[model samples]
Target: MAMDTPFDEFLKEWSDNIDKVRTGAGLLSKIRDADVDVGTTPKTLIERRDKVELFRYDPIAERSVDTPVLIVYGLIGRYTMADLQPDRSLVRSLLAKGIDLWLIDWGQPGRGERWLTIDDYVDDYIDEAVERICAETGHEKITLLGICEGGVFTTCYAALHPRRVKNLVLTITPIDFHADVDDPALHRGFLNVWIRSLEASDIDLMVDALGVIPGEFMSSVFSLMTPMRSIAKYNVDLIDTVDDRDKLMNFLRMEKWLADRPDHPGSAGRQWLHDLYQENKLIKGEFALSGRKVDLGAVKMPILNVFALDDHIVPPNCSKALGQKAGSKDYTEIPLPGGHVGLFVSSRSQGGLTKNIADWLTARDG
Candidate 1:
């Protein structure tokens, strides 16, 4: 055979690329239409309120730790992401480590819930759930693990009822809203910049008009934050792993979680934006859960603050501030290396971050 010409090589390479695209399209179709099962880690519903449900995951190990963990997710997202898939599940990893986990599923809000405020969430729902978990586990105080805005709730609860929380864990949670205001490195944090840009009247008008912030609206905002994410990342990533079934499914599972957004209650949304985002009341010790001021100094329980170094939704500075503000004598701030969602599902986080949480809890496990 004659030596292959440059033109021949170029044609062959182009043809190979075309074949990959065709294969990727077929895989994408299956992902779009296939019935994919997620949040398969078994959990039992322990309690239910209007739209909130408390789910307790059975221990995968023969025995569980003395103190249990209660996972509270952000209001705008489903808790299912914590247990998205067996292999990539924070819930699974914790359970396998004998850590009993109870999750709060703040179900989709309705028109009636529009009047519900953080007072209702923290004083009523979260308190009741904590009581239920304590009763079940025969432990007076449970480890409070909060994710994102849920972290705000837990922090409020810990301050209000410090005796009820044995150890507090905040993952990608913002403690000081204005902590990164002067940090050029964290200027890319879209949520921080976007919220700060809005005037108080603008926030009030939006919440008042919508009643509840539409889940679709919030999801669209998230998508717009990084336009290339919606357009380029998926196409490039899918192509890279088009022939790999497991990788494609992994991607599809994450997409499913991101799409599963929940409507935030109007009153709560108004308070959150105005008080925490706008006024920076949380760090200033001016935030009120119901009628009482939430004092960060009351967070005396052993605390673990896990923040992603590359987080844009809640900048690392916002999360790291917990170490300085909380009253915990044993406060630890873990600086991770990813964005908000990546902490739970990314390959870099598979065993690393989850193990860190488990070990931290275990060290203080009574």
Candidate 2:
């Protein structure tokens, strides 16, 4: 009844091609492992045997900029997204640009770490990391570049201890959770639906079963936001790019990073949902990490608020309004023409945004 001849031929060819690609990927992984061990650096292999489990990627090595910088990644994903590739990595770019960069890796959380709270992370852990970097570098203050929820955390830190911050770079960061309901991404119901479901079901049991939050579950959230492209269309396009060596390698790397989700500590995740989302306390200046109140208006250092114009996670009005709230005399705004993730990943952004940040660092260093 159907066109069996052409369909059957196509199916057979597709299966053969899949097998070939599988073999090729296996070889590529081997060559990649053999040629370069990117993780085997002096700055990496962090000693996290203490009370907290963390990793570091010091791109500057021994040398450092006059203005030191520490990058804080978001909560949901691993820090590798910033260093997704050997070629266009943000760490590599900043290092080449002569900015001393120290990246903190909040390692995958185990079941034991489920009770870790926001107060524990920011006041105790991140503060200790900051002190260590400062003590080692001999700089009283360090530039902090925080992305996504990391930006939110950095904001709190800056407000709490203004004297220890040199420059603050907040990117695609959501501050004003009390956004208009029309904005589907910012609407409470949007996140609440999935978040509530996770809580209602034995998601804790699922998490315990998986040990860490499964990448597939995290990936499903991103897919659900754009059901058409992520679920079906992306794989269709991957078929065409399979022939391009460089593109395929980049694809694989991005996919690998995207598949790797950070295990959000139960306490921290619960706090995020309650204080940040439902209560909307962060922007209201009602949030307190410890005894100190988190008031963004207390941030006195020079601020560079970077936001993607098209970012769905952090809307334009929300991210752009930081310049008004921040107490910095030298405040700037840069709205990149990309999505939340694309602000760092887009080829066009790498060309301009990286240089702009480098130039800013250079100008202020002296």
Candidate 3:
């Protein structure tokens, strides 16, 4: 072989870049053609109601704890993110750690379901699911792990029926809507700021216009919060992962989840915006669901309040208040490095988040 000249080396670099471009284009084509599979975790549907289902994942490991952990995802999004894939799945990680896992899938809602309120979710749907899980597992008390908006519902459930929940894990759950009023973070949560500007009449008109809050509308609002994210994700980010088929597929899986948001009931949505977001009633113990008030002090179970250090949607201030309000003497606050969604599926957080949850539950499961 002859010694390579500078010009030849430059040509080789250009050729490699061309190959990378080809790979990126091929991955993009696969996405456009719908040739990818998303949310492929194997599970068995144990219970079903009108628009909700309780799913129990098949054990990933031989060993498991007796106290089952019930996972309640927010009504705004699907629970598929918990089990995005085998390698990066929170459900799989928990199951492998010998922790029994159960999840709730609040199926898509219709206009008729607009009357469903926070009370119905906490009292009827969530309470019934907890009962079924307890009945099936032969356990008197189960652990509750709530994500985002579901964290608020779980907090209410645990407060209302403290005897049923043995341990509570809240990840990126917003307790104080005004937590970030003075935060310097550019994305200090547009939801918090926007809600402050709306009046009762404004909320009523918006709710009346759409009997049930449209998932698409909510998606658009989040999109607007990070206008450049979509562009960078499809272009720069996709190009970086395109060469790695697994990474490319994982990116697509996340996108698929984001695209599959669920509609929120109009009445519940109105209450969430006006009471919790606008008035910050949950923390003040003034928020009522069905006919009962939610007292955070009643959350006396062994508590693990986790928040993303750089979370934009739910700021650190929003989630950080859980530890102070909850009555549990065993409360622990974990401010991990990641954004709101990153805490779930990002590699940087997937391990720490799941491990912290498993370890905390193990200590308190008895």
Local distance difference test values of all predictions, in order = 0.86, 0.70, 0.86
The total of clashing pairs for model 2 equals 0
RMSD of 3: 2.8
**lDDT tens readout by residue for model 3, 1-366:** 352898888888678777888987886776652655655667799999998999988887875477898999888888888888778788889989988788898999878888888889999999999999989988899999999999999999999999899988999999989888878887777878877887889878877987788899888988888889967987778767887878888888888888889788899898899899999999999999878889999888888999999898999988888877889999998888888888878899899998888888777756
Where model 1 places Cα greater than 4 Å from the true spot, the runs are 1-10, 28-34
TM-score of each model, in listed order:
0.94, 0.81, 0.92
Ordered list by lDDT, greatest first: 3, 1, 2
Number of backbone clashes in candidate 3: 0
lDDT tens per residue, model 1, 125-178: 999999999988789999999999999999999999887899999999998998
Which of the two, 2 or 3, has more TM-score? 3
Itemize residue pairs with steric clashes in candidate 3. none
lDDT computed for candidate 3: 0.86
